[model samples]
Target: MASEPESDAFHEAVPLAELEAEGRALVAVEGVPVALFHHEGEIRAVNNRCPHMGFPLTEGSVDEGVLTCHWHHARFELSCGDTFDPWADDVDTYPTEVREGVVHVNPTPRRSDPPAVHWRERLDDGLEQNLRLVLAKSAVALQDVGVDPAETVETGVLFGTRYREGGWSSGLTILVALANRLDDLDDEDRKRALYQGLTEVTSDCADQPPKFDQEEFAARDVPFERLESWFRENVEVRDADGAERTLRTAVAAGATPEQLTGMLVAAATDHRYLDTGHTFDYVNKATEALDLIGWDHEAAADVLASLVRGLASADRAEERSSWRQPVDLAAMCDETFDRLDDLVAEGEGKEWKRPDGFTDRLHAADPEEVFDALEGAIEDGATVEQLARAVAYAAGRRVALFATNNEFSDWNTVHHTFTFANAVHRAAQRTETTELYRGVFDAAVNVYLDRFLNTPPAPEPSPDPDADPDEELEGLLTCFETQGRVNRAGAHAAHYLDGGGDPERLKAELGSALVREDTGFHTFQAYEAACRQFDLREDAAERRDLLVAAARYLSAHYPTRREREGTFSIAARLLDGERVHGADAGSDAEVATGDD
Candidate 1:
C-alpha cells in the first residue's frame, strides 16, 4: 500500500478510491506506460512492462497485495514493486501520493546513467588482485595436501581472474590448473569452494558478450606428465585397502582419468597391491577418473565393464562389496541399453559402431541375441537374479517392438519365450485364453523347465582353496555361454519326452540319470515326478535314504536354511536315536522325544 517516491515536478493526481476500483489499470505518462495499483488502502504506480522479458504488468492480476505478470508469472509487491524473487529484477517504482481526495504523481524526467567506466576498472582490478592472492594461497594449500604447486599458481591466478574479467585467453589455462591441482585438496569443503568460485568466474565471462576468442580458452595445455609424476611421488599402492582409500580420496579431490591414467597403469605394471592377483584397483581408478571428467555414455560403459571384468575373479564376499556387484553392473548396462534404445528410436539412421574386439562382440548383435547370451552366461555361472533382469530387458524390448510394429503375431522363438512367460503369469488368476496364447504359454513353460532340468554343470572350482571365492564365482558366472543353443536343446527335450514324442526312451534315460548316486536332489525330484506323473507309491527305503541324504546335506552346508524347523531333523537324527512318528503327537511327547 506504499506510495511511489516524491519528486519536484507536479502532475495530475487521480483519486485513491478511483485507482482502487481500477486495479492493475494502465496509463501513458511522459510517453511511458505506467501501471497503477491500490492495496492496503494506499495507491502505488510502477512501469507497466516487467523488468524481465518485458511483459505487461498492467494486464496482470493483483493478488494478496502483489502484482503478478500474467505472461511469465513474475510477481512484485504492489507497495514498492520490489521483485520478491531475486531471479527477476525489481520493477521501476514511480512517485505517487494522496492529497486530500486525489493522488499526486511525480512527473520529473528520469536521467539515464551509463555504467561508470572508472568503477568497472576498479572492480576489475580488485577482482584480479583478489584472485591472484587466492591462487597463491591455494597453491600452498595444494602442496600441503600432497599435490604439486610448481606451475599451478600462475596459471590459476591468470586464467581464473582473466576469465572473470571477460578474458577468454586465460580461461583454458584455469581449467588446466584446476585439473592439475585436483588431487591436492584433501578437505571436501575447500575443494568444492575452489571449484565453485572458479566455475562462477568462468560462467560470468561466458554470460557476457563475446569480447574474447573462445578458442583460446579451449587450447590451454593440460600438464598430464606433471600430474602423473605427482601421483607417483605421493600415492602409495601397498594393498587393496590402501588402493581403494587412495582412489576414493583422489576422486573426492576431483582427479580426472586422463590425468591419473599413467600413474594407475604404472601401478598395475609394477604389480603393486595386486590383491586377488587382478587389476581391479586400477580398473576402479580408471572408472573414477572417467566419472570425475564426465565422460560420454559409451566411454563410461566401457570403463564400467572393464572394472567388472577385473573384479570378476574376487570372492563372493568381495564381489558383493566390490565395485562390480551385479546391481552396479546391471545399472550401468541398463543405462547403456537405454542410450542405445534412444538412438535407435530416434530413427536418425545413425549407426553406433560397436566396441572393438571380443569384449564387445555382444554389443553389435540384436537385442534378443544379446539377451540370450546374457541368460546363457547366467545359467553357466552368473547370478540367476541378475540374469532375470536381462530377461526383463528383452521382454521390455519385445513389447516396444510390438508397439512400434503392431504385429504381435509375428514374434520369433526368443520373443515368444519371454512374452509367453510374462503373459501366463499375468493370466494365472484368470480363466480365458485364445488358442494361440495358451499354446505359446504351454510351449514356453515346457521349454524352460526342460532346459532348466538339463542345465550343464557349473564351472569347476579353482584348484587353489585359498583363492578368493568371489573371484572364482565371478569367473564362473561371467564366462560367456551360448544360451540360445541351450534353449534349443531344452525345447527338443521337451518335444521328444514331455510332449509324447518318445516317452519310453525319455523314461529310460531319465531313470538311469536318477539312479546315479552323485545326482543328489535331481534324483529326489525325478522320483517325485514319477510319483506325480505315473501314480507310483512312495518307496519307503528310497524315501528313507533320500531323507537321510537331505538331512546330512542340510546339517553340513545349509547354514542359510538352518533356521527352518525342518532342518533341525538332520541334527536331531545325528544326536538322538528316537525316530519321529506320525504328525499329531502331543506337544509334551514331542518335546520329550525332541530332548532325547
Candidate 2:
C-alpha cells in the first residue's frame, strides 16, 4: 500500500516493504512513468525513460550506488542521476523519502536554476558534444523564454569557425541562411529553423580537428589600400596562407565591414565570376554571418579566414570554356573590367533612371546587347546596390521562368545565377565600393547566358482569387510528395501569394517543406535567396515571381530519401522526453521526427 504526503508534489510511490522486497518498482508519478530503486540502504527515484532512447530503467540492474540501463549500458549515479556516459545525458532524479512505512517521491524534480539559464549552458554542451537532442532541448527552452535567436546563431558560428580547420563551411553558411530567413517564418517555426541550422553546423564540426589561429601583421598602421591589394594579390595566386594573413591584418587595422566586404567582392570578381558565382554568394553569406555573430577583429578573423581557402581554391570562371566559346563573354568582361574603374566613377552618387522596359532588356540573348544595357545603366549613375537589385531581379526572372524541359540538374545552373545575383545585391547594399559593380555586371552576364535554360519559359501562374489560400498551400506542399510536379508546384505557390494569402504562412510552410526533405547546400541557398529577394521587391508581380522560383526549385528536389531528417526527428523526441523504446511504449509507438 502507498500513502499520500501533505505536499501534492510528493506522490506516495510504493510501500516500503513492496519496494524493498523487489529492489525496484515502476510507478506513475504525475503521469510520468517513474522508476523507484531500493539500493545501497537508500530509496531513489528517477524517470523510467532512458535519456538515450527511452528504455525502461526499472527493468535494468542496480549494483552499489549506480543504475545501469540494459538497453545501451548507460550507467547513472542513482542519487543524482548523472550519467557516466555523456551521450545518454543526465536523467531527472526526484527528491525521495520514506514515511510511515511508505515511500514518497516528488513528481516535480528539484531545480537549482532557471530553465533559460540552464538551457543556455546546455546549448554550449550540445555544440561541444554535437548532440542533436541537447541542442534541440536548449533551442526549445531558450526560444520559450524569448532569447534572441542571434545568440544561438553566434554559438554555432564560433564553434563552426573554431573546430574546422577549413574555416567557414557550408554548415555555417546554411546556419546563417536560415538565420537570414527567420523573421519570414512563423514564431514556432523560427525555433525549428534554428535547430535545423545548428544541427548541420554541429555535424560539420563533429570529429574535425580545431582550426589554428591566424595572427595579423605586427604593424596595425598599414593602409587599407595596401592590405586590400595584398589580399587580392595573394588570392589571385591561390596563396591561402598569405591571403589569410593579409585579411587578418586588414581586420586588425580596424577595417570597416564595408571595407572587408569590398576586399572579398573585389577578389571574387578579379577572376571572372569566380566559381560560377558561388564565390560571391559565399562572401555575402560570410558577411551575413558577421552581421549575426559580430564584426570585431576576433570574430572577423575566426570567420573570415575560411574564405581564404574558398577563394584561393575556387575555380575561376574565365578558366572554363563555357564563358569563352559561345560569346567570348569573359573577353567582353575583360574589356569592361579594364575600364571598370572609369565606368564606376561615372556611376557614383547618381540616380538610376531605368531605360524604358529595361528589365526585359537585361535577359537579351545577344551578349553584346546585354553588356550595352548594363554599361548604359552604370554610365547613367546607377548605384551599386541599385545595379545589384536590378541584376538580381533579372536573375530571379531567369529562375522564375526556368524551363522544365531542361534536364533536372540544370536547375542548379539558373539557381547559381539567381543566388549569385542576390549575394551581389546584399553585399552591394553593405559597401560603396565600385568593385561590386563588376560583380553586378558579372551576374547580369550569367543571367543572360542562362536564358537558354528558360527559353520558351513555362507559362507563369496567376493568382486565383477564388482559390482558398490554405488549400492552395497544402496542395503546394503535396506537390513535393510526387515526382515531376515542378511547374505545378510553382503555380500553386505563386497563385497563393497573389490571392491575398499570408506571405509569412507561405514562407513558414515552404521552410517546413524544405527542412522535411533531405536537402543539400544549394537548396538552402535557393530558398533563402528567394525569401530575401522577395523582401526587397515591391512590385506585386516580382514577389509572385520569387515565390514561383522557390517553389519550382524545391519541387525539383523534393521528397528526397529523407534519411537525415529522420535522425533529427528521433533526437527531438528524446529531448521532449518521449519514450521511443522499451515495453512501456508498447508495439504502437508514435515516432517523433522534429519540431512539430
Instruction: State which candidate has the highest lDDT.
Output: 2
lDDT by residue (230-262, candidate 1, tens digit) is 443433322333333333344334445443443
Where does candidate 1 have its weakest 10-residue lDDT segment?
Answer: 429-438
TM-score of each: 0.24, 0.91
State, as a TM-score between 0 and 1, how close model 1 is to the true structure: 0.24
TM-score of 2: 0.91
In candidate 2, which residue pairs get closer than 3 Å at backbone N, Cα or C atoms, i.e. clash? 569-593
Candidate 1 overall Cα lDDT vs. reference?
Answer: 0.35
Candidate 2 lDDT, tens digit per residue, 1-596? 12433465687878999988999988876666778898878888888888767787877899889899999899999988888987787778887877899998887765456667777888888888888777776776788788899988888888888888766767888899999988877765677778778888988888888888767789988899999999999988999888999998988888889889989888988877877887788788889999877887367777888788889988888888888996788899889878877876887777887666777889887888888888878877988888889889899888888888998888889998999999999998899787777888789888888888877898888667777787889889899999889889998997787678998788878998877676888899899999999988788888888988999899988889976466556666665666576445431122211112
| Whole-model Cα lDDT of every candidate shown, in order | 0.35, 0.82
Clashing pairs in 1: 313-471, 314-470, 314-471, 315-469, 315-470, 315-471, 316-470, 381-477, 382-477
